[model samples]
Structure formats: C-alpha cells, structure tokens
Target chain A: MTPERGATAVAPVPSETVTRRESTSRRVTGPRPGTGWRQRLEIVVFVTPALALMATFVLWPVISAARMSFYSWRGFGPMDKFVGWRNYELVLGDDVFTGAVMHNFIIVFASLAVQLPLGLGIALLLNRKIRFRGLLRTIVFVPYVVAEVIAGVVWFQLLQPEYGVIDGLIKAVGLTPPEQGFLGTPDLTLATLFVVLTWKYLGMAVLLFMAGLQSVPDDLYEAAQIDGASWWQVQRRIAIPMLGPTIRTWMFLSMIGSLQLFDMVWVLTHGGPANATTTMATYLINQGTGRGNYGIAGAASVILFVIAFVMALVYQVFVLRRDTKEAR
Target chain B: MSRQKMRTFGGGGPLVYALAAVVVALTLGPVLYGALGGFRSNEQLARDPAGLPDPWVTSNYTNVLSNEAFWRYALNSSVIAVVTTVIAVLAGVMAAYPLARYQFKLREPLFMVFVLGLLFPAAVAIIPLFILVTRNLELGNSWWGVALPQAAFALPITVVILRPFLMALPKELEEAAMIDGASRVGVFWRIALPLSTPGLITVGVLAFVGSWNAYLLPLLLLREDMRTLPLGVADYSTEHSADTAGVLAFTSLAMIPALILFLALQKRIVNGLQGAVKG
Candidate 1:
C-alpha cells in the first residue's frame, strides 16, 4: 500500500469520449441487455456479507451500548428498569471514574509529549546511512509486535518489589529500592506505566517519521547543503517541516490508542496499586464485568466513545484538515 | 541516498551509534531478561535477580512445552486467529472490490461507515457486545463468539488498505475482459483477485496477528478450555505466581508464534502500516 505514484494521471482524459466508447462497446455487445441488472446484483452479492457482519457486530453493539446506558441491568434478566441518566450521573460523580478519566488524559498527553521528540530524534539519527540500520529498526519494533499482555507480564515480573530485576539492579548500584516496587507504589504506578508505554510505542513513531522522511525529496537536503546550511538547520527547516502531516497523523493515532488503553494496564496492574492507572476502558471493565455494574459500564463506554469521537472530529477539523485537504 | 554519498555528506557518527545502542538495549533488555530468566531456577533468581542462569536449566521450557494446558491455549489461539483472518479477508476484499470499482451512489457513504469504524474502539462496545454475544446470539464460550466481533473490528482496516489496491488495478484489464464477453464477476474473480494478492497478504497477516494477540474479547467471551493464549498467560501467571521461572517460560513460549510470524513478514507488516497511514 505504498502511495500510488501515477494512478491519478489517468483522470484528466475527456470524460465524454470515454463514456461514448464504453456505450458503443456495450451497444455492440447488445445481446446482454440485462447488464445493468446483473451489475446491480453483483454489487449486492459482493457487498452484502460484509455489510451484514458489520451491522450485526459493529454498528449494533454501538447502538446497544447507548441503549444500555439508559437502563439499570446487572448483566442478565430483562431490561425492565429504566434508570434514565442516573448511570451517567453516578459515573461522572464517582471519584474513581473521574480519576480514570484523568489517567486517560494524562496518558494521551504524556504519550505525545514523550514519544514525539524521542521518536523524531531516533528517526533522524537512523535516517542517516548507518550500519545495521535494518536490524536496529527491527529490534526497536519487536516490542510493538509482541502481544501487549506478554509485555505487561514481562514488566510485571521485572518490577517485583525485592526480587525483580529492576530493584535488584538499583540495589546493586548501592541505591535503595522502593519497598513496594515501582509498579506497586501508587505514586509511581502511572509514571511506570508511561515508561512501559513509551518502550512499546516509540518504534511506531520512529517508523512513521522515517517513512515521512523518505517522502521528502533528496533534492531539498542537497539544496540546503549547497546553501551551506548546517545539518540541524536542514532538518529543522526542511525535513521536519516536510513531516508536518505525518506528525499530526501520528499524534491523532496516539491519542486514540491512549484513550482506549486497557490491555497492558489490565495485565500488569489490573488498574491496581489503588486504581492509580485506571483508564476509561479499565474502569468500564471493572464495573461491567468485574462487579456486574453493566449500567455504569455502559455510561462510561458511551462517555469514552464521545470523548474519542470529539477529539477525532476536532483533530480532523482543526489539525488534520490541511494534510487531507492537500491530498485532495 | 547511496551509502558513500551519505558518508561524504556526513553520516551518523560514534555518538549516534552510542545513542542508538542505548535505545536498542533499553528496548530489548526486558524481553531478553524474561526469556533468559526462564532458564534459571527460582533459587537462582532469588539469589541473583539480574544474573544469567547458573546452569541454563531446560526444565522450565520442558515443563511448559509438556503441559497440556499450554498446547490447548495455542490450539485455541490458532483456530480463532485463522477463522478471524479468513472471514475478515474474504469479506473485506469482497466489500472493498465494489466500493473501489463501482460507481454506485451509496458507495461513498458505505466506505465512510467503515472509515468511521476506525475511531470506534472495541472497549466502547465491549459491554453491550458481551450481552449481545452471550444473551442475544447465545455464542458464549464458542470460537465464533470472539472471532465474529474480532473480524468485524478487523474489517475497517482491511477495507481501508485493500480498497486503494483494488482501485489501483489498471482499468483496461477489466475493460478488455469485459469486451471478451467476461461478466463483471468473471473479471473480478479472474483479474481483480489475482492482481491484489499483495494487498490480500498484507491484510491477512495483519488480521491474523491482531486476532492472535487479542485479549479483551477472548477474556470476556471464552471460558475454561476456550481461553486463548493471552488469557491463558494471564491465568497461568496468576496460578503460578510463585513459580516465576515457569511463568516466564510460559510467557516466552506464548510470544514465539507472534514474534516468528512478525519476523517472517516484517516487510509486509511495515509496508501495510505505511499504506494505512498514507491512505
């Protein structure tokens, strides 16, 4: 799916001539007068299965979640009790839900704050002709490819209070380790989760930045060099500016991924250490599945959806419009 | 772009290498430690938490490999991933074909529906999806219970990636086939499907990897023997909380399939991401 180079080059031909030729061919092959009906049938046959699956699985659940938020249901039985907006009120007023919302926003901002510069720095360094570039890139991306649960499990072991490798290393250097371990300490849990997230996702940013760099024509760099510009100046003025669209796109994705953060946090701490790392997703799961508070979970899910949808919409309008508009 | 020219134009120096080395070490350190820690006995780990195994015991690996539960998880994961991939690719390609090639008025709106699906995370729908699957569909504890939704989620990315590929196929080929009396279906089956193999492979690999690594859906849907590897790993880690080495072994073994698949198709996966981003 690399960008198609010349696909649009065929669009400028006169449309009337093309339609006339196609019509003449169709008239010549006049035996098949049922072609229109046949084509419509083909469209139906080809598209129906997917449309059905999506409607049933994706669209239905979304609508159901909205419907579910209005009623008080444990998980089973009939939907008799209509609680109206009580669930939303409860979810919003609850300190834990508010805390989860805070954590989600923290991750969303923290990811962009930490990963953007680090990934860009690495991508810049690696874009140079370097030995073992391919191998280095692969190693960086391996964690991303690994299952989130597995990564969480590995980190969970590494952060064990006394016996974990991290504490052991700290002690080896003559510094005292945390009594409750990094992940165990309520104050440190969110920070530790952020660190793990950076480890897992920075590679993607670097990869994307590198791809964006590849698309910046070599001549720009050459021209900058001819003008006696410094390396940093070239990157700042030419390379990075050219990467605007890529950076915005990456940030949008990162924000969405962060808001939905669940897998790693669930496996590692279960949003534990006194729920310090509870995201919207974890809070919903903790309510819906863990305690059978399906109504609260539904409300939380709807809130999460709305937050993500608004952010995506705003980003598309305010931030991403330029990139997409340029493409069009 | 040539290496020699790059060097002449001031390529990366020792400082760059040093920084890159540090980043790589930090990235791979925990993963390597986990894999190697499995070879150490509990006592050895207790004694030297960061040290290598004194005598690389094989029992941890052997025990996990021998355990019937581990294999069951693997089998369940394989089946679910395969089913999810097949359905997602087949349905995704079929839908993407007409959306890409046809001039129907509803095509744009339909494609937009899938595009909007991109922003809809499974977490948002997990609650009602649970109710729908278990209570309404009665697919609880079955492979389809998880695979169906997973495929549904997979559809957006699949269509997004595959549509451009279908659209990029030279129009003359289809026109030629039509002139030769081949029906639209004949043209699609004979021409469109064959030429879009790369796109198919890209989407297929992505779907399979996604299904294999999926956790939340399988966690809720599947119970007992139906649990996939991620759930199994969580359960085993909890059950064997004291057996750190065994947990490590199980975790490492669980990751191998995904890692191996990734290594094999590393290029396509990277390209696919680029494609998605660009699109």
Candidate 2:
C-alpha cells in the first residue's frame, strides 16, 4: 500500500532531508515560530472524519481479521475456542486453497504475457492516424466501463457450448467445438477465464500505454528516422524504452488485480469445474459466507493480505526505486 | 531516411485499416451482441445466435422493466451509491485541505494511511467486515452496512485526487480573505470548495460508478428485498435460468445507469484515470 504522498516525498528526498537538518539547525540558532494549539486542533478537525471512517472500516478490519484468524468461530457464534494455528494449517493443507493460489499465478502470468502485449499492440495501432480513432478508442474502453459481473454474464453467454456465438463461429468455419463447453470443462475453464479477463481488462492497459505514448517526444522518432532506423528499431529502442514507467505501473496493477480476482469467477463459474477457475478471493468468500466458517475465512484473509502487502512492498523497494531515482 | 519513413507502417494504409477493424471487432463485438440479444426472443437467439433479430421483441425489456423486483434493486443501488458518493466526497474535501495546506508533522503519515487504504481491496477484508457490521455493529441488511465501507474504501483515491487540486490553489486568495478577517473555515468553504469543482466531479463520478457496479459488498450485506442491481442481475440469472434473453435484458437494465453516468463524464473519467496513472 504505497501512498501517493510517497510520490512527492520520494521525489524531493535530498531537498526534504536538507530542509529537515536546516530546520533543526535553525531551532538551535534561534527560537522557532511555534504553531499554536488552536492551529493543531484545526488540523485535527479537518482530518478526523476521514481518519475515523478509515480506522473503523479498513485499518480496524485488517487488525481484527488477523486476530479472528487465531480463534475458532462460525457465522453466529462466540469466538470461544482458541484454534491457534489450526485454521491456517487447514488452509495451507487444502488442495482447493493451493489450486486457487496456482490459478491466481496463472492469471498473473497470462496478464503479463497476453494482456500487456495485446494492449500495447492495439495502442500502437491506434496511436497512428487510423480511421475512426475516437470511435475505436471508445469502443475498446466500453467493456472496462461495464461492471465485472456483467462482463462475466455476457461472456458466459458467448462461450456457451454449441449454442453460443463462439461455437457457432467455430462451426461456421468447419471446426469442432469443445464437447464439454467452456466453463464446464476443467482443462479449458482457466484458459477461457483468461480470455474473458483479457477482453474485460485490456482496454485499461491500452489507455495507460496511450497516455505514455502521448508523452514521448515526436522529435525522438523523427531523429531516429533520420538516422535510417527502421520502424521496428524505432519502436524497440525509442518507444518501448520511453514507455518503461507506464509499463511498470500497468504490470504492477495487473498483478495485484489478478491476485484479487473474484467477481468474474464468482459470477461465471463460482470456482467450479474442479476449481480450475478458483482464485484466492473466491476461496476466501467461500469459506466466509458460503460455508459460514469465519475462522477459516479470516485465516485466508490474513494470508491474502500478507501476500499482497509483501508483494507491494517488495515491488516498491526493488522495482520502482529505480524509476523514482531516474525521475529525480 | 525520408519523412515518409518517420511515419510508422505508412500511417494510413489498407493493412492498418484492417488491423484497426480487427481490434474494433474483438473489443466491441461481444458487448454489441449482448445488448442486441436482449431484444431478440430466446428462440431467435438460440436459432440464429450471431445476427440481428428478425422479430425483435420488446417483451424482454418490458418484462424486466415491469417486474417489481428489478425496480427495487435499482432503487437500492441508487440510494447506496448516492449516499456513498456524498459522504466520500465531503470527507475527502475536508481531509485533503489540511493535507495540502498544512505543514504539520502528522501530515505525511496521515495522508499515507489514506493511500494505503487503496491497496486493501475489499475482497480480502470481507470476512472481518462481515462480522463487524453484522454482529458487532448490528447493521445487517441496512444500506449503511454496505455504503459506509464503500465510502471508506473510496477515500484514498478521492483524497489523492483532491489533495493535488487543493495544493494547486493560490495561497494569496486565502491570505487576501484572511486579511478581511475571515476565518480559515470560512475561507475553505467559500474559496477552496468552489475552486475544486472539477476535482470533486471527477472523484464523485468515480465513486458513484464504483458503488453502483459493486457486487460483493451488497451480495454479502443485503438480503432479498434489499438486493442491489448487481445482486439482482445474479438473481435474474438463477431465478430465470432458462430465460437467457431475460437475463441479458436484466443485465442491460442494470448497466444503463452506470453507462449513462460514464458517458456524461467520459472525458473527465478518461483524463482523470490517465492522470492518476501518470502521477
């Protein structure tokens, strides 16, 4: 959970550090102009409402979930039994949980490989003076504006066996459709889910890349062309390198998004067909509500929170540090 | 190299047009088909699954529109989304002002807390939230049960957007007003709020659409009578399992409000999101 404040904070690292030392030295040199208690109270008044809600809803729940994970409880019972690590143990040993984790990674892999490339290609194509640029951009972004559950329902219809549009098109081209249907088959469910994910998500990626492309100086391309650079070379050495920050941002978003995949899976397959499409989110919801085992669900929630927290922290430190330094 | 070589892939050619067409088809084709499918009969859909309906029936739309359940769900969604947007925006404005204008010690850390809120996706916290709202708070089935958490979750992005806008306001205006003996609160209300209208609208639209499109929170919190549009969409799927046309119709109905909002603020949303990523 990297804060936006961190963006400004990280950017002015040297200056801020210098100012901090200068302020301390100034305090040593002379009496500082002290802020009144009234001013401090006013700051509190301004920030308290949001801070209160965030504490109750986000921060408190995170802490409570960690605690709840340690005790055995059901949906409507007291948390009397001290289960210790039993719930975590059960979750760790469960095949469904493991499968869900693997499925999340599959989505991450697919998103990195398929979604980003497809988005970049479409963005590049649209970046040119193609026909109906506005219309095409709007059309591509339409799916993203639509809700995830609705996307799930729409794709569910399209991927229906023999009767769906995909199968109909397959038949029209004289090919055999999958016999067990898309969502109904274990081997094909995750892959089909990937297709739907790509369709629903690629637009955002395209938009991000388009924004990045807009910032790349036209003179760079012109200069490269004058150097007798081929179109591919210009893209490889100029466009792609220039797009590093945006690409990194999109990749981070896509990874976290894949980790938290729930609505589509819940609506379309409910992690069925041998749990092929199960994600950690679906697993948590299943334990929490579908089964009413709050303790197990709490354990799952903590695990997910830890994974996401660690991933974000590591990504910020190792990956984004270079970008921030380069920007400075 | 010639100036012609500077243009990638010759800029405008048959091949580029062909590729653009393919991209368009792949992106918009399914949504268009789904929307049109609602107008066709179930039999029509089953028979000719990929084209315009010969006998485009209004019954599906009529059926969903006339159904009391659909309206109830839509009404619930509106109430929740509206309440959440209002609370989130108000709180965001209040909180962002201090973060932007003050150089207090807690300013960065407090702002960071709100930013960290963005990283906690609602999915992971549902369990504890369920317990806290239902058992501890006794807010089960109420609109606030869903709305409060939504408002809370939205604060990070709302504050993120608003703080920068607040920071950009000229301090001389506030100083000029203070010279006239106006209080800080009065200056904030009369000056800063009016100046940040664009940022407010941007955050409001984002929060509203997000609340309306939300599925899991309402799914967990509400009962049958209190079902939101998304839950209603799921209900339509289950209750009318055999009626694909009706399901699609219900889906289209649930979508229209959010879509209309997005279309109205399309430019703001697009630019705001683009700026968010770049920032």
Candidate 3:
C-alpha cells in the first residue's frame, strides 16, 4: 500500500505520484493475490460499470459516428455504400455548417463579453462584507440552479408581447414594446439566448470566482486599502492579476459549456425562428435525431469532439503550465 | 465635494441598498408572475394578464393533483432520482476512496479519464449513446435507460470530488482502527464513510438535481409510456400550446420538484461546486 500522500496531493497538484503510478500499472509486479492478479481483476470489476458505460455510451458511440462520415446514410436506413470523405466534403461544402461554426464563434464572444465579465463582477462585489451578503449571493446563484424548464417557463412569461409581465411592466413605465417576444425574432434570438444562458450560468461562474477569490489573502487587501488605493484600483491591480489562473479556468469551462449548449435552447427555441440561433450541438441533434440523418449527425459529433479536445489541449499544455509558473 | 462624496458612501449604504432592491426585484419578478399566472382564470389571464385571481382559485393545484399522467411523471422522476443518487453515491464513494488512498498503477490515466468525462459535454457523446441504448443494449424505453446513463455520467466528477474529501480523512483515526485489527472494509465502512457523509450528501444532492430535471436523455432513450416529469411537462405544454394558461399551469407543476430540490441543496451544492472546481 502506498502510504497516504496527504490530501493536497490528491488535489490537481500536477504531482509526480500520479505519473509514477500510471507508468507502473502497465508493467508487472508479478501476478499474486490481493494486490496482484486477483486485485487487478477485482479493480476491473469495480471499474467495469463506469468503464463500460463510458465506452459504450461515450467512446463506442463516438467511434461509430466517426465512421459514419464515410457513408451517406440518412440515419434511418442502411449505409448506402461508403462515400469515403464525402460527408466531410458535404459538411465543408455546405454554407449552413460554416454559418453554424461562425455562430459558435458568436457564442464564444457572448461568453467572453457577458457571462465572464458579469460573473466576475458580481463575484468581486459579493466577496466583500456587507449586510445581507448571504442573501445577495444566494439570489445571484438562484439563476444557475433554477431548472432550465422553469427558466424556459419564466422567459416565456417575461417575453410574451401582450401578456409578458416584462412587456407590461415596460409599458407601464412607457416604452413601445416589441411586436413579439425577443425569441420570436431571428436577429434577436441568438443574442436573447446568450443573455438567458449567461443568466443561468452566472451563478456557477460567480461560485467559481469566489473559490479563486478566497485564496487571495485578506492581508493583501488590507495593505492595499491602507495605501489609499481605490476599490476599483485594488480590484484591477490585485484581484485580477491574482486571479489569472482562475480566470483561465472559468473561461475554459465557459467555452466548453458554450459549445455544449442544448437543453434550455432546445426547450425555448428548438433552434427555430429560421435557425438563427443554431449552435453546433443544436444542429447536430437536429440532423441526427430530428431529421434522422444519422451519418451527418455522427460527423457533427466528431467535429464537436475535435473542437473541445483542441481547446482543452491548449489549456492543459500552455495556460495551466504558465499559471503554475506564476504561482511559483 | 467631500460632503457630496460622503452622501454616496457608507460602505455602499442606501445607494447599494437601492441597487440590491432592484436586483432582488428583477430576480423575483418572473417567478412571482408565473406563480400568479396559474392562479388567474383564462379570461383573467388574457384580459387582466397581470392581475390577481378573482376567486383566488387553488383549483390549478387540484387539477394538477387529479391528473394521472402528472402523478405518474412525478412518481417516476422521484423514484429514478432517489435510486440513482443512492447507487451513484455508494459506487462513487467506494471508487474514489481507493483511488485517493492507493498508489496503484495507471492511477493518473484513470483519473484523467474521469476528468475527461467531466469536460466532455454529454451532447457530443449523446448520439452514439442513443444508438447504444436502443439497439446494442436493448434497454431503451425504460427508466434504466435514463437513470443508468445519468449515474454513469455523474460518477466521474462525483467520485473525483469525494476522493478529495476522503483524502482529507485523518490518518491517525484509520491507523487506530487498523491497530484494533480492523480490516480495510471495517475501517472504511465504520470510520471513513461516516466521516465523509457531508461530501456524500453534496454529491448525492447534485446527482438528484441533475437527474430530476433531466430532459434530453430521457427524451432520446424513452418512449411516450416512459416519460419523466420534465419530458412530460415539455410535451404537455407543446400539445396544449393553444391553451397558454394550461401550458403555464403545466410548467408550474414541473417546476415544483426542482424548486424544492434547489431549496434543499443550495448550501451544500454551492460549497461542493467550489471544492470540486480546482480538482
């Protein structure tokens, strides 16, 4: 048994222990009992459910879908002869796919512009002591925890042109309400979804930022305060720079989440109003499941994986290492 | 100038209070509207859309309770959620504690695989997941179709989290138990498990929230007969689109269980999310 290496080692500390263990697993310590042949097999028993599910549902499906790129199967039927890269060609050939990718860029932009800033800003504000701090923090987080179906219900209520409580409230204070719900229009739909998503995810973001924030010591804040640094100045100079690692993490997560956008959009818009808000996820699902063009859907899935994998690689390779150096 | 600045200050007093009031109002406004929306009659919904009920009808609740489909969906969701949480927590805790305690081979790769599971949005994996459930596994159109996949997906992160909490376990306590001739199982079951109940509860509650409000997985894997609360509500709302009031009522019904879960899990889940972020 490896003696307990302490709790912090179990954390994501980039430990050598992790590497050493993985390297040794493939090599043999000779088949024996408890910690040997029997143990390894039992470990597989412990791991099999998760492994099988991950493989069957996650890995196997992905591999099958990747192969579908060679066929022109419309999802419901037999693969009508391999077209060999034709699906990739078709996807590349199509303007809709290009637009979808471009729109995904919009989602990235929206996250950077709205959710990141808003979440960080709120987190910074709430991190300080003030009366009712608990209440305020909880209120902000409510959006994230609220069910998407309920958020869909709330947004539907708020945006209803005639009966929309929001519209009525706006008119009560006097502004010409739009003819329809913002989601009912094409130009506004994606932006509107962006806002709702930001709202829903802001709580999660703030929670993360708070975690990063707590690690920055009170002594630093006190010293800065004594030096006559304004609140904003301290925040910019101390907090932001101190939070570099966390910001990267939050941004990385937001990107992954943005790419994976589904449930709420599916509930609220169903990628409608002429597909103005079409995300890669929505488009993939639409083709694969909705239209039953399984091959194309499979292709979309592979592309999604490539995109997420590439981003995670960059984060793991460059940014995470730099953050480590900064801390050291 | 000093006097003017002072008026705006007091660690952000009245002004901050005013702003917070706006924040609270904006946050609560829609929920207030939806809750009240279901109360008003259809004519009241259309004519005096923002007004309170004339008869102050509680019949929406009664209507919701009387519907067999509604009760069935609610029951299905609760049963699935409770079962999935218990199983996931037990399995996740066992798996995580060993990984945290052991210096076994392939540990990092296994850990990475679990983290990879977290980072992969189920949407991408969902397509192949559907085919596997329907044809390969032949488990389609059942609660197991949804519950099992949810437990699997949730396990990776949930386990990673509990590992940290378990590693935080005091070595002396376990050593003492071992000195008493306690087997590994005895130590874990009696000591470590009891100590980490907080972590277990956090993971369990989160799993509950995720499964209870789940839509897409159930929608894909299950047929009409197997609809859960979320799927049922979404479908019912769509079918009764012409009945906007009815749609709101249905949405309200769907929202209750989630609302209750959130209220219950808010403190633990928030703290857990913080703990798990770095991991």
Strongest candidate by DockQ:
1
Model 2: residues with Cα > 4 Å off, grouped in runs: A1-35, A225-231, A324-328, B1-10
For candidate 1, the docking band is medium
By TM-score, highest first, what's the ranking? 1, 2, 3
Count clashes in each candidate, considering only residues at least 3 apart in sequence or on different chains. 0, 0, 1
Q: Can you give the lDDT of residue B224 in candidate 3?
A: 68
- Candidate 2 CAPRI level: medium
Scored against the native two-chain complex, candidate 1 gets a DockQ of 0.59
How well does candidate 1 score on lDDT at residue B123? Answer: 97
Q: lDDT by residue for model 2 over B30-95, one digit each (tens)?
A: 877878999999999889889797778889999999999999999999999999999999999999
Q: In model 3, what lDDT does residue A137 have?
A: 75
Top lDDT: which candidate number?
A: 1
How high is the TM-score of chain A in model 1? Answer: 0.88
Question: Which pairs clash in the backbone of model 2?
Answer: none
Segments in model 1 whose C-alpha atoms lie over 4 Å from true places: A1-34, B1-10
- Count: clashes, candidate 3: 1
In model 1, state the lDDT of residue B104: 65
Better of 1 and 3 by lDDT: 1
A best-first ranking of the candidates according to their DockQ comes to: 1, 2, 3
